[model samples]
Target chain A: MNSLMAIFRFELNRILTPGRVFWWVVVAAFPVVIMLLMMNYLQPPRGATQENINTFFTIALYFVAPTVSCMLGALLIAAPAVASELEQHSWTYLAVRPNGLFHLVLGKYLVAVVWAASATIVGVTVAVAVAGIEDPGDAQELNQDDTVVAATDDRAVRRGGRFPGETATDVVPGIVATGEVGRAMVGLAILSACSYSALYIMLGTLFHRRAMVLCVAYTAAVELFLGFFPAVINRLTIQYRLRTLLFDWTTQSDEFRNSGVLDFVSSDESAFMQVLWLVSWTAVFLAIALVSVHVREFTSASETDV
Target chain B: MTSEYLIELDHVTKLYGTVIGVNDFNAQLKPGAYGLLGPNGAGKSTLLNLLIGQLVPTRGTVRVLGQSPRNNSAFMKKIGFCPGFEGLYATTTGLDWVTLLLQLHGVRSRPARARAADCLALVGMSNDMNRPIATYSRGMRQRIKLAQSMAHEPTLLFLDEPFSGLDPVGRTEMTNVLNDWIGLGNSLIIASHVLHEIEALTDSFLLICGGRLLASGTASEVNELLFDSPSEIEVDCSEPYRLASVLMDRELAVSISVEQKSHGGDTVRLRTLRAGQLWSQLPDLITRNGFTVTRVRSADDSLQTLFNSLLKIHRGEI
Candidate 1:
């Protein structure tokens, strides 16, 4: 435990350099910049209801904050955890200590997750604040005749109890509740950080020589490419689990279902089940990373030639 | 009771694909200071890696402190290793880097900092400990590497090419630090291709070549081998023929030849089995004959030449 904390603290200190902090600022401000541009150039129509604007900003937040910001942040931090050590010829020093490899991997994973999560959560909150959430009573007054309200009411009646979206609005009776949207996006950001950091750490351990390239390839192929198809394989990805949780928490499932684009999500699974899957995948990736670091021979480049 | 031997390797062989790294090596080393002397590509680094648990043997076993080094954390805690390569972080200060490594050994932050400071100071790095390592010279980097390795005060320390980038004064400082370390009664195994560097630290040596152990002996034993081996000597002189004739008559030269130089005088080159005798008698012969000798140089006195002689002896060629 002491070794793990030592590694964690040391790595965190190393990550806070001027250059790295600049890049982190760029990551956190990305969604806010995009949201500002979208609100300026792509204003809602004159007759469009506040619900439509809320849904648009919510989806934008999901894609930019949890997906882009979190993925990029985690990738930059975690994908080079072992490769950096090896390139610098510093692995032998750390590998000789008791539980060194295990602590190193876990410690770097924690730092990556914290750094990525903070960036995404801050990005989501700033974007939400910039886009502006209307008062709940005013939004409800304007959304009284909207079809989304009717659909939400129908689903609530069918489910025989209040769903997450309805319960989220008990204090504010509107579709675009600031507290609910911010909470859900922040939760997904944390999940996205944990899951992606673990996956990238595993890649870093297994293919340390080409860790960053392999991680980028895996993210592009498996997470982005395969995540689009409405197949069983898509169900196996963290993207699918995170997206399902997003729709469930934000009450956006009915809208996607009506549009026939909900085929990729396992709607049959509850939000709890989706969280369980994400957590389980994180555990599996972390386990593989720890085991790989333990058993693999990570000699210096010169020694490898010998 | 503690184990009798600090390290034991039994028929250890490490193969990188088809190339042999350490070829069926065997050794049982007691706890003391020893040097691993070899030319480049002689598998000294490979053997060090094997003993430090960075590489596992393909055919045999390695035991350190009576325990297998492979994945043996308890054994790892008792050993420290400083690799031959430059492993310092460029952007980090020397103090921070060493302290962090100590922390990895389960030392608390406060004590780790204090110990790192002391070790750095011992290596003559106290004044520059707070500077970024990127600003350090090659010798300074080497000193910092040594500091981190010994900061934890392990029971055993393994150093590979510890004198690679040191200047004369830096080498003296490093030798002093290592001598002090040995004075503490801790075991040390240092690998280097330079003979004098190892000689400055320890008398015992394990000579390796072509991934095989050629011989193991003390400094005096190695000197005896040098004395017995046939050595070539060249004398630049005004009277090459006279010097060659005198050397032959004195029975110091097994073979002698005099060659005409392009400039002032001729040069006399001779092969002798008794170089010490030749050196001792040459001045008297020169004084008696009044020969104008300018320079006397030994042709084969390098470590590579020594290893070649040992290899020849190992093959029964001498």
Candidate 2:
């Protein structure tokens, strides 16, 4: 429809404004340094059979996706979500024309998704390609050896991923590639970015100016906190659900899957069941966001009252 | 082009729970110029919002261009409104703002751009087209607000205090633009407390008080109910001495006295519009052949009486 296209064009033009573009460039370009580092001289041990390149790419995204998506999508939607229009006194300018509550909510929601998706795609793709090109040594010890616990000193990079050791360095630590399963790892990084964007956009609508506080407290106390707990909270935290969707986990013995990580939740339930949980929670949050948009009065603070 | 009345409200009343916005209001409006004259906090803004279908009434129905205005696109297209406050996109350029408005009204491409330019020119702000509204002065902002309202050629205009915060020059320009807008058989409903400003724009008025319809008619009709109290009349007598002597003995007349002043020799001023009783007997004392006389005017035809009578009626002691 022309109206939908007009709304999309208007929203895209708004995001491409100078101030927003400058910030997007910064967020999109942060993982390029990691890519450059990996391309320098990190070849695998001579004569070591190289696994598929896709695993390394998934390993790369594990680092950049979490940081970039949180800052870009979670924090970015705060402005266009609800408060910016109030500051501009643009209600009459917007409401007079028939961009009713539904259109307004839909337009902003779509922009937030596209914005986060663009930033996340860059970080994920570059990290994936760069990780695939570079190689790490000691394949048997890293992938299969039993008593070889991950060393702490070189492991301080601590980027989360599909693997068990330093063989991967994108942003988050530990991307492991077993056998010939590479493409599934790439799919995992993308799923992480999308799920995170959806959750935060819903939060942005629910809490207008206080979005940062909610995200920080939720990320720290709930997500990181629950990830540490031995209980089944992985079904709720975004990080856990994202990790559950990425790696092809069979039993609970994989290094990244050991004990209190995402594996504990996966220890009992199948990967498909965990994905269902992620989707159900996403639906719940989206429903809350729609209600928030409908109830919150779109009054401008500067010149309008009551 | 719809030939029927653009807006019609029948006993529309709105209450914010206990506090009332507009109470028992009824109006039949055709396509012409109309002024909604009322003091501050007089519910002028409330009535305007109801007409636009932004707020629903508790009691009666309001029909704009024959359909209920609530989400009625066909009716909304014919009515353009500038609310009590300046609702502008502070970041948008003046030209782009109007163009967007016209485009939303289904004006496409180059013609929308051309019409936007013409609208800015009519509001006397073509030079400031590139500037963001955030940087504009109050008068310039008001002009842009008007340009957006009229850009789409709406048939019914609802302007709530459009002349507020305008300098004398800006006021004249805005009034002229609105007057010209209504010249093409279009209608305007404007609200203002400035009597002189309202007087210049339209003679018909709606006086609102305590969320009630206090008075509605031509300006003079409301004025007559407000100020004309004493039964006084001006007489052009043929014989000054004889005519002056005749009016001295009336009981209802307040000290029936005659004073001579300006204009050719002697003149008398009286304070009444009920001149029929005085003219019947005044010819008895004076002969027209002695001196041919000319003018007769009501001394109490002042706005002060209308204002006082309005206040009295508001207090419920009248």
Candidate 3:
């Protein structure tokens, strides 16, 4: 445990340089910048309903904060954990210590997760605050078409048998309240960071020479492609669990929930089950990474020459 | 492997694919100081790596402190290795780097910091310990590497080319530190190609060439090997021809050649198998013949020549 904390503290200090701090700021500002741009240029028409605006913010926040920001942060930090040490020829110094390899892997993995999660959480919070939620009074005025209001009311009732004004604080003009969605997005962002960091760290240990390339390929083929395939394999993806949790936590409209477009997300699993699955998969990846680092031989190019 | 020996390698061979790294090497090093002397690519680094458990032997076993070194944490705690190459993190300060390494050995933060300071000071890096390593010179970097290796106070230390970047004064300082280390009853195996560098620290040597142990003994023993080998001596003299005749008459030389010098003199170069006998009889022969010898020097006094002779002996050539 002491060695693990030592590695963690050392790596944290090593990465807090000016160059790394600049990149981290870029990652954290990404979602906020996109949200500001969208709100300015893609605003709803003068008489447009509130459902369109809410959907835009919800989907945009989900993709930008939880998906892109977290994925990029984890990829940049975790995928090169072992490769950087090898390239710098510093592995021999640490490898000679007692349980050094194991602690090194675990400590770096934790730093990656924490760093990526913090960036995503900050990005999501700032984006949500800047793209302010729509007031129900303004929605009632802009949504002038009586047919659209009745349809929204029916959808809200189907969602949880609660009208918009019946419980004004609990229900927003759209499917769920802004506070509930913001909390759920933050939770999902953290989970995304943990899961992706674990996967990339495992890849780093298994393929030190080509870890980044292999991680990108895995994300493209398995996580992004197979995640939306509407097959049994989709359940094996982190994206599917995250999407399921999002839907379960916010209680989306029944029509959208039953729609065949998002058939990849499992409706049967509860939110707790999805969280358990994600945590279990993270543990498995971390276990494989620790084992690989412990058993495999890693020598620098010069050492190999000797 | 018995606990009596600090390190034991029994017929150990390490093969990097078809290339041999260390060939069928066998040694039982007791607790003491010894030098690993060899030319470049002579398996000195490879032998150190094997001893530190970085690489496993292909066909034999290696034991350090009476236990297998491969993945042996307890054994790791007892040994420290300073590699030939510089492997420092460029962003961290010398003190923090050493302290962090000590922490990896299970020392707490406060005590690790104090120990790191002391080790850095031992290497004469007290003032510059807070500077980032990127700002350090080659010699300072070498000192920091040495400090990290001994910070945990291991029972045995393996240093490969530790004086590679040190100037004369720095070299002397590091030699004193190492001598002090040995004086404390710690075992050391310092690897270097320079004969005098090793000679300054310890007389015991493990001579290697072509990934094999060619010889192992004290400096005098190596000198004895040189004395027994066929060697050449060049003598600048006033009467080279007469000296050559006298040397041949006494059978002190196997072959002798005289060359005319540009300065109106001659130099007699003689190859002798019995160098000890030649040296003993040369002054008397020159005095009796009234030969005026200006200068005399041996051509086979370097470590390379000694290694060549040992290699020949290993190959059954002489």
Which one is best on TM-score? 3
Ranking by TM-score: 3, 1, 2
Writing each residue's lDDT as its tens digit, candidate 1 over A149-205 gives: 323243323322123333322221222566778899999999999999999999998
Interface RMSD of each: 1.7, 3.5, 1.5
Error of 3 at A42 (Å): 3.2
Over the stretch B142-163, how does candidate 1's per-residue lDDT look in tens digits? Answer: 9999998899898899999988
Per-residue CA lDDT of candidate 3, range B184-268, in tens?
9999999998877887888788998878988887766887866667778999998888788889988889999988888788889
lDDT of 3: 0.82
How would you encode candidate 3's per-residue C-alpha lDDT over A1-306 as one tens digit per residue?
A: 988999998998888989888878888999889887775566344433355556556777788888889988899899999899888889899889998888888899889988899999999888777765534443333222332232244433543222433422232332235687789889999999999999999998899899899999999898888987788999999988988887776645445555665565554677899999999999999999988876776763257445
Residue A126 error, candidate 3, Å: 0.9
TM-score of chain A of 1: 0.85
lDDT of 2 by residue, B1-318 (tens): 443776678899877668777889988777677777667777787887778776677899988777787655676677787866875766778987787667666667578789999999998998998888889998888888888888888888888788877899999988888887777878888877666777677877777766677787786677555443444556564455554554555432344446666554455554433344555545553454354556566554544345445756687655
TM-score of each: 0.84, 0.72, 0.86
What docking tier does model 2 reach? incorrect
Candidate 1 residue runs with Cα over 4 Å from true position: A43-49, A135-175, A253-260, B222-253, B256-270, B273-305, B312-318
The reply for model 3, stretches above 4 Å from the true place, is A43-56, A134-176, B222-228, B232-246, B255-270, B274-305, B312-318
